[model samples]
Target: MNFYDFKFVFYLAISWCNLLEVDGITVAEQLKDVLMEGYDSSIRPVNNERDILIINISMNTMSVLTLDPAEETINFSSEFILQWKDEFLFWNKSDYNITWLKLKESFLWTPDTTVSTSIDTNYLIDASERYVSVKHDGTVRQSIYAVFTNLCDMNVDKFPYDQQTCMIKMGPWSYTTQEVTCIVGRDIAPNDTDFGDFHGNSEWDFEGIVSSVGETEDPDVNFTFSEVHFALTVKRRPQFYVWVLLIPTYIITVVCIFGLFTPTANHGLREERVNLGITTLLSSAVILQIVANAMPKTSELPLLGNFILAEIFVVAIGVLFAVLVLTLHQRAHTREWRPPAWMLWILRMTGSSKFLSRNITKIRHKSSTAERIHYTGEGAYLFKNLDESLQSVREYIQEEDRDYFRELTYVKFFDRLDFLLLFIFQVGNALVTLFLVKQ
Candidate 1:
């Protein structure tokens, strides 16, 4: 009774265990056994080795991070959508009661698309956290999120108003064009929507995107490979530069010009204007250094640099002319030194005689107004030694010398110069600013 009953119960338990319902793990195990029987990732997923595989790829920019003009590089966040067919991974949906399988990218064959313009020589599009979606029809889809740092073609000639273009090429790293081809899906541009949470470029605007597919040759190996190129155009936002750098420099120049014309009463225009000019030059130099720090080293000067340089030039000129005007003021040391007839004519011709005299009537008022007279203190002494017959003529000439000094004093000359120089420099500043803007 003991031996027969124990054997029958053991056989009954084994039959019940084998009759239990199969689960998800069992279905997956059966699929793996059938699909990965002789799978090899090194070779293309095709029945014949000579067949070329076409990989459809599209990249959508999520956001732009930065663009370094000095370094000639740009960094952007993007996603790569890649689709290809893997014949070996195909399975009947009815057999496993499943339409698709989400597997690790490492477990399946993936395209080795290289970023040709990447700044890092060992750049990699990491997909460690991603998966390969294999459908029932043998089609595989994968999405790789990567941050690309690549070379950019920038035109800083306009600087704050400038636009930049960058090209990103993706292709097979090792395979030739004959083995594989990469096509940029022009119709696959829908992934670039700004979904309300997208953070655009911090210092620039995302202008537009253009894509194309072509072939390239490896110089070292002489192997032709297919490539998909993505060209991105971005425009710079000038608000930061306009408010911070440009406006300050412009204001300094205008103030320096107005300061150059301050009355030469207290400290004199020479000292006051020179000090102001030097201060402005130093300030401009500091701002220039800031601008230069942000720009790449180039031979041709950019528009902003040119504007700052012009400001420095105009201030230097004002300082120089101020010294010259103050020197003319010193000629009236005794209040007896006279100006030349030409100087009197110029002050009157420019309608500045009244302004220079500090009144309505005291400027360039000659005694006789007959082409004026020219006589220094030495000339008067020499005339006294002339013959008696010419005594009256010499005496008359001596009297006229006083008229020349009284009519146009060196003080008037200095004032005339101040009026003229102020007008000239103001016009010069306007012209320089306008030219830089238009250029």
Candidate 2:
């Protein structure tokens, strides 16, 4: 009776201890259930209406994908870390035997902020899994990876040699600044040392990044909203355009000027020069079109546009100069017509006076010598018909000299105008180029 009773009592004591242990485990499980029962994921973790939901944001640019001026957008990949405190998620780490817990984003509350400049067609190129971490202090941190195409207002007024400032702006879509405020994360310098890792774009060189906070009033929402801006400063690498567009345009312009020197007397040469000028003009127009297509459509003209226009003007002047020379040459073929006195005076003023005077003196001397010789050979016969015959000879010689001088003057005039126009064109072209290209 003593042995049986002792064994039964020990077995009963063990059963009671097991039941208590099970109850304790159930109580521990109910703690988490109790904590989550009334929790609302949609509500901010703040006790008072005056309390602000402060979200700390940090961004690391993975790469610059594309910068399209014509489309007025810049595509880039980035890693964003958002951190905030959720007072409700707080718990004693010792009680749960857990320092931190990883949860899906849907299981926690997050700021309603979104990228404002994201394009509509493809807002995000690629995204990583959304993750949330809850610390013992109730601080919830989320890490997100996405490729964003952001709107970039381009100032192409200095295009090709332009430095652009593109921005990535994020703010609460519905919350006002009074309800939620954004601050830069603890890592204030995002992507500070990771610039070398960027590889998507070859046309632009990343200059630097700038961060700032801005506030604006939205009438549609009837609230003042706060925004965190990440400004990316970049510069275009113009070597591609310099070789492909500028150098060729410059060559065509120079060749057009050279065409002015082609002889106008030969029909083939004159046509060749004209054709060359026209071809250069057309080539410059094509280059301008190409540049225009590459830049955003804007009201103001760019520096390259001005340069192309100047080149076109210079080439056009060359064509006009050639046409004028040809017209003068054809006019010179008319033997009966003499240039107007004002026209001759202009030629003399333009450095043809010395040659004209020399030719005139030679003709006068020859006429005097002929008259003197005729007078000496037939003195008696010359005296009888002196007035009439001498008058006829004098008029004939003057007409012959005038004809010779007129033709000579026409040729000299054409040469002087050609050189003067060429010199002016060269000087003007150089000045315009220095002003536009060098600057």
Candidate 3:
């Protein structure tokens, strides 16, 4: 009875012990599984380092989500809870602030070391959640550029949506910055309400900035970070050339056109006045040439350039008119009297020098006046044909003296009116050209 009872009790106890051991093993395995999962959620293996929390954020299609150095890049596999900062704390600055942006997105972080991840250019920024920071002495700059077929056709409305998201192209995927600033402005941020005067140069269609900041020269500050945005727009036509070249050319042409008013009937006239007009016209032409040289050659003429050429032509025609007027005055004066007054003023204005004075004196007195003076010999002459001759001579002398007074008055009037008309024409031409050119 003792041996049998002892064996049965031992077997029962051993079986009970085995069952308890199995239950204990199962509990231990379950605890180990739970601990593994907890380790994964709380600790991240990064760059051979362990135990790091992760942060995740979502942004808009063209939004920037800058990460703090302490948090680094986001881990794609981690679960994140929604987080937000007090909007008033950031937006309550004395200067204008954009508070509405705070309500749209959230950012998540957990003191996690960052993992490297590839970002696709086609990927839109998730605007629903984003991370932000306000570090002591922190500064951020953003620049945007719109790439268009031509800058000349571009308008203010066609500019990029966000300066922070817009980028200027440099290389295949690079860009250079046109501006840098901590605060957002029309030139820096799309959200800026104030637009500075922007002149578009069609040649500079592609614009952008560096994505990362260069190292600061100061030794105290060891790290530098920067982010840039870029954009592109298509254009319809070229406009830069017209504003830069044509406008100035047109103005100069108007000045050249004023040379036409110099009258040809003046005894005071000289060749130099005409020459001066020619020189100015030539100079304007040279300027036109320079403008042409700067631009790409095309069959179409610039509107301003055409106007300049027309002005030069007009000057040439005026020169011809002056020559013809002088010829007419000379022929008419031979049969009649003095040239017109306007012609005289022009001659005086154009040829006040010795050369013109000498030439005019020589031409005007070359024939009848000088010959008559030479023959007259400063003495009155009497002719006789007996009684009739004597009586007729006295009557003839009296009538000649009387007619001389009337001829003088008529000649003077003609000279004055001609002079006035010539002057008015010259001045009028100048003013009209100026007005047209300005327009």
Candidate 4:
């Protein structure tokens, strides 16, 4: 109970409290350990084997850059580059034919089942030889063609042609394997121009160069692509319409020409021939329109239409010629441009008229005593002079009337003139079209 005793008791109490605290700590620690062991034994750590490298990229937008056409050769490139959200493609030049990795699909009306079937160039190629040339050696560029469903109704000639939806296929050489993907871009419309004799239903076209940024069917892969160059050359696929129309038109045209030979003296013959010519011209024009409906319009002319028009012109000229000839024949009969007295005198002395009289006499003097003899010398000499004089008169009259005849020959002259004009125009057209269409 003294101070030391008190201190010792206090220390003992403190020690007891400390021991109790220690005991509590020990119990708590043991509980913690047991819980930790149970927790560790009951559940295992998760193993994540997710590949974070591969990602899917989508091209949903496209933009076309302005073209610089000052260069004799113009180049069009795209600003749309490939992008993946999570990870980028690990591409290599060796991993693929990067220089030619552009995507392209075979365009066949009917897919060839044979591996080695003679096929026209699947892709258009510009080369020195056009018809028989088939090779993979060519420059690459971006080019496209839009093929519509009903081309007959498409307003190809409308100014600033409205951009139309078309099936687009982009790729490489006829033999190269390609893979490409592009975002839907702005629609390309045709320019407005009034192409004379040219139908406005032209095929749509586009040209550019596409660079490959990644490989298809392979994720996280890249390849270098040669600029896939293209020159859109859309040929009008004649659905045999031009030919079908041409056959009937040509037949009718021939029939009209036959009308020209019909004798005008025949009842209503001249009127019928003129009517037939007009009808044939109109029919040919309609057929031409049908052809134009299937073709594109440009600031140019159509060769086939020109040819048909030329034919119509020829027929019209023939009709005019027939009318002129008939008028002249009637005038000659009325004017009495008969043989002159001097001409008759020379003819009689030559016995040419006498011989005619004798022939007539033979017919009229049937069963009568008439001596007939084939004389020469004087008779032959006179006959020759008479025939010569007759030929001279015919030539003189024709020459004297040459101017009037020429005036009347308007129909024939027009026929020839139309041929010349159309020929010159067509040649110019061919040159111009070649230049305009050249990519």
CA-only RMSD, every prediction:
10.1, 8.9, 21.0, 25.1
Candidate 2 per-residue C-alpha lDDT over 114-186 given as tens digits, one digit per residue, 9 for 90 to 100: 8888874232523234657878788988766677788999998877788898887887887888989988743
Estimate TM-scores for all models.
Answer: 0.77, 0.73, 0.33, 0.31
Candidate that would win on lDDT? 1
Which of the numbered candidates is closest to the native, going by highest TM-score? 1
Cα lDDT, all candidates: 0.74, 0.72, 0.35, 0.35
Ranking by TM-score: 1, 2, 3, 4
Cand. 3 TM to true fold: 0.33
Q: Could you give candidate 1's per-residue lDDT for residues 314-355 as a string of tens digits?
A: 988888887766665654443434455587786664443333
Q: Which tens-of-lDDT digit does each residue in 58-132 have in candidate 4?
A: 112222222111111111221211211111111333422132222122210111111111122232333222221
Model 2 accuracy (lDDT, Cα): 0.72
Q: Is candidate 1 or 3 superior in lDDT? A: 1
